[model samples]
Target: MKLSTRIALWAAAVVPVLVVLAGLLLLPLVGRDLRHQQDARLRDRAAAVLPSVRALVAADTRGRPKVEQNQQRKVVDAALDSGVRVTAEDGTVLLSVGPQPADDRAFPTAPGGPATVRDRGAAWRVLTARVSGTGANGGSGTLWVSEPGGLAGDQTAAVRRRVLLVAAVSAPVSALIGFALAERATAPLRRLSRRAAELDPAAPPTPGTGDGPGGGTNGGTEGGTDVGPGGAPFAAVRSGTAEVDELAAALALLLSRYDEQALRTAQALETARSFSSAASHELRTPLMSLRTNLDVLAAHQDLPPAERAEIVAELRDDHTRLLELLTALGTLARGDLVEVDSFGPVDLAELADAAAADARRRHPGAEITVELPPELRVFGWEPGLRIMLVNLLVNAAVHGRGGPLRADPARVTLRLAPAGPVALLTVDDAGPGVPPGERETVFHRFHRRRDSPGSGLGLTLVAQQAALHRGTVRITEPPTGTGCRVEVHLPLPDAGAPTLRLPARRDWITGGQRGDRRP
Candidate 1:
């Protein structure tokens, strides 16, 4: 049922019951009050005749029998009008009046006190008083007065009827008023319900962020609006309640977040597609060159010694470079796909030591020195950290300029220290440093200095590794003032274990090299 109707029905049903209960409680009190008034009238009449009865008794004691009879007759005559009766204790009737049967009895043995009794079949209310005298001839006597109980009963019944009548009449009118008030109170809720019912979920309203294409003037109706892909617009229904407005605001916020995430996903997909296409195209040229060189060698079963040896060496170097380039590309792709869960606590000093040992074994001719602090802890992926350190050292060893190919030590130093909340790893070389203008470009994918024979992805991988750990890689001039120094600043883990931070934006490296003038 509607709320108003329900309230009305409840009020109608309950009010009459309350009225009836009140009437039931009040009827007895009304009856008692009416009986009190009747009793008072009876008492007043008895007092009036008492003086005359005393005079009659005094005459009887003085031996004036004739005067006593006349006085008794006078008393009896007066007492009849007041419904009273008088009697002596010695079985002598003094005066009798009103309805008193031959066997009708007075109140039993109540001395010196007023008593009451109901007369049988008469609807009368009665009161009795015992009269006492001093002389021997003057004995105790009884005086009785009565009034009709019918008047009190009728008054009580009248009061009960009046109460019932008023209750019956007022019930419907009070219920109608209550229903009207309830309807007025629920008007806002009803309007809100109707507005909600008209809303279509399939075509949700577009949110107005500002004065954009989808946004309109005047804050766009103070409600949500949905703009479909084909430029269709629909207005969301507004509930004027504050809680509903808050809910709508929260929903809009969630939708906007979803849109941003979807856009990022699309951009990442596009980047992957481009990477795959570019890698395939680039690998084709190297593969073709290698194939051509092999074909030429195969055609000559017994070639000139120097020529044959030169061709074989060229083939070996190309093959090695090709393998290195492909490996670097694969590493870069893996870094791109790395999620936050792959990170953990790593000791940068330990990683550096391992990288140094590996590099020394790989390049026995190079001079490598490692200066690491104890337990230089950072949060990052262990494999990525190792790859970054090995690449930095290798890049330095391959590119550092010293004596003519063999005499000078290719001095490389790996140092790690705790700098505030960051673990700083710096790789320094004794070689011609990156040109001031080209330092930033060297971190871009496939970027290389003109004289460097290394694949351009080495520093790019370093950049990616630093980014995954919420860190940064920068090229600073070496402390020796002669060569390049690469510093990676990684955030230290609180529990000495690696924790992943927010994913780094791809533009961290790309944005740094956008305006490069190098070919």
Candidate 2:
């Protein structure tokens, strides 16, 4: 049912019943009031007639018939419309006048105040007054006055019937009024519904889109009054009603989320395509080399021992290179796909120390020293952080042999300290430093020196991991200018606390890491 109709129906049902109940509650009070008024008037009549009644009784006791008849006339005249009855102390009937009970036995014997009595089916208010003389002890009688209850009762019933008619008439009238009011109240909601129904979800309003019909782009929201993202105007949802506005806002938010998800899906697809294309291009040369090596081995089984060993060594190098390339590519893909849930509190000191230890184990002759506190916490994905540190150490092992400025070969130092709120980790190597121009470029994919052994994905992984952790990485000359120092500043857990929040955007493989701070 329509809201207005429901309101009208409810009002019709309830209002009449309420009116009737109010009348019922008032009826008793009104009836009592009527009886009280009748009794007051009856008492007044009794007072006026008492003197005459007393006189008549005294005359009768003295045996004066003329005086008794004169007093009886006076008593009857004073009684008026109320019934009157006079009786002596011995229950001897003295005089009767006006309207009264036909049966004298029905009269109250002892009546001081007004009371209710019935004769036949009619109710009456009766009052009794003692008619005692000041000087004449000859006569003492009870004077009775009575008035019919039906006088007030009839009036009350008439009023009650009229009130009931009014209440009955008010029901449909109230319902019609209620329905009109309800319709007026719900007008905004209907408008909102109509406008919302007209909206096209597919052509959603986006930020910076042109204003369309009604001087606004009809996109994200449901109305024309409010401008949504891209400045598109919503046509109808928010109709100035609080409930409608709130619902419009909720719907807009939901649609906005759906759009964001769609965009993310598209980005994910693009990232996958880029990964496949890059992998194919990079793998072709190595695969060709592998095929050539295999062909040579198969064709020449009787080749000299030294030549065979040399070919085998080259085969091993190619195989190893291919493995490392695939591994680095896989790791980069994982970093790109990493979610926020994989992140947790990692002690930078502990992680750096472990990486330093591993580098020491792998290249014992290469002096690797870690100078850091027992624990400095930062929230990050463990595998990503480990990838960053491992790549740093590996880079130092491969290329950071001591240069002319420092005689020691492959010596590296890692230092960790707090720089305000961020943890600063600097990996210093004792080798010829990276040039100022090439520092940033080294983090780009497939950017490597001609003679570089490993795949060029190592520093790219480092950059991706740093970005993933909402941190920054920079390459600069060390204090002595003998080697390059790569500094990574990760916003630390406040006072050894871990706060894991990933960056807003993550497509490191497809979209390059744009926020790497350079020095």
In the order shown, the candidates' Cα RMSDs to the true structure are 9.5, 6.5
Clashes of 2: 14
Q: What TM-score would each prediction reach against the true structure?
A: 0.56, 0.75
What tens-digit string does per-residue lDDT give for candidate 1 at 48-154? 77776766655655557887688777776666555666666665666666654334563334533223455555466667777753356655576666656677889
Residues 205-292 of candidate 2: C-alpha lDDT, one tens digit per residue: 4432322111212123333244333434454344667877777676566555554454445556767887788778888888888888
**Candidate 1 CA-lDDT value:** 0.68
What is residue 250's positional error in candidate 2, in angstroms? Answer: 7.1
Each candidate: how many clashes? Answer: 8, 14
- Candidate maximizing TM-score: 2
Q: Give candidate 1's total backbone clashes.
A: 8
Query: Model-by-model lDDT, in order?
Result: 0.68, 0.75
**Where does model 2 exceed 4 Å of error?**
2-8, 40-82, 85-105, 159-163, 173-274, 295-315, 363-365, 402-408, 495-501, 513-519
Residue 263 error for model 1, in Å?
Answer: 6.3
Model 1 lDDT, residue 212, Cα:
17
